[model samples]
Target: MAIVALRAPLKDLAGGRSEVKVDGASVIDVLRALEAEHPRIVGWILDEQGRIRRHVNVFVNGELTREDAPLSADDRVQVLHSITGGTA
Candidate 1:
C-alpha cells in the first residue's frame, strides 16, 4: 500500500487524518481509494472529466506525478492544493 499524505483542507475533509493508505498501482487508483474513504474529496481533487484539477498537485515519493504515475507498496504520495496570489 502507498501512503498518501493529505494537505490541510483535504486532511480536514478526511476527518483530520493527514495520511491514508491506498493499495493502488497509479495516481488515479490512489485518488479513487481516497475518494472511497472521503466521498467529497473527488470533486476537490478531480475535474468533471475525471482529470486531476489544475489547482491540485500530486507528488509520488517527493517527485511530481501525473494521473498515470505508477505506485509501489512503499511509495509515499502527497496531494496538495495550489496556492496563488498576486500583488495589488
Candidate 2:
C-alpha cells in the first residue's frame, strides 16, 4: 500500500486530517481507491474529467508526478496546493 498525504488546507475538506493510505499498482489506481474512501476529496484532487487538476499538485516520493508517471506499491503520493493566492 502507498500513502497519500493530503496537505492541511485540503485536509480541512477531508474532515480535518493529515494523511491517508490506499492500495494500488499505480498512482492513478491508488487515487481511485482513495476517492472511494474520501469521496469528498475527489473534486479537490481530481477534475470532473477524472484527471488530476492543474491547481492541485501531486507528488510521488517528493517529486511531482505527471499523468504518465509510474507508481509502485512502495511509492508515496501527496496532494497539495500549487496556487499562490486567491480573491481577498
TM-score of each: 0.90, 0.82
Question: Per-residue lDDT of 1-88 in model 2, one digit per residue for the tens?
Answer: 8888887766776677777777887777787788788778777677778788877788999998865577877687888777753555
Model 2 compared with the native: what TM-score? 0.82
Q: Please, what are the lDDT tens digits per residue for candidate 1 over residues 1-88?
A: 9999997889999888999997899999988888988887878888878798887889999999899998889899998876642235
True-vs-predicted CA distance for residue 81, candidate 1, Å: 1.6
TM-score of 1: 0.90
Write down the lDDT of every candidate, Cα atoms only: 0.87, 0.77
Model 2, position 65: C-alpha lDDT score? 86
| Candidate 2 Cα outliers beyond 4 Å, as residue runs | none
How far is 37's C-alpha from truth in model 1 (Å)? 1.4
Best-performing candidate as measured by TM-score: 1
Count: clashes, candidate 1: 0
- Per model, state how many residue pairs clash: 0, 0
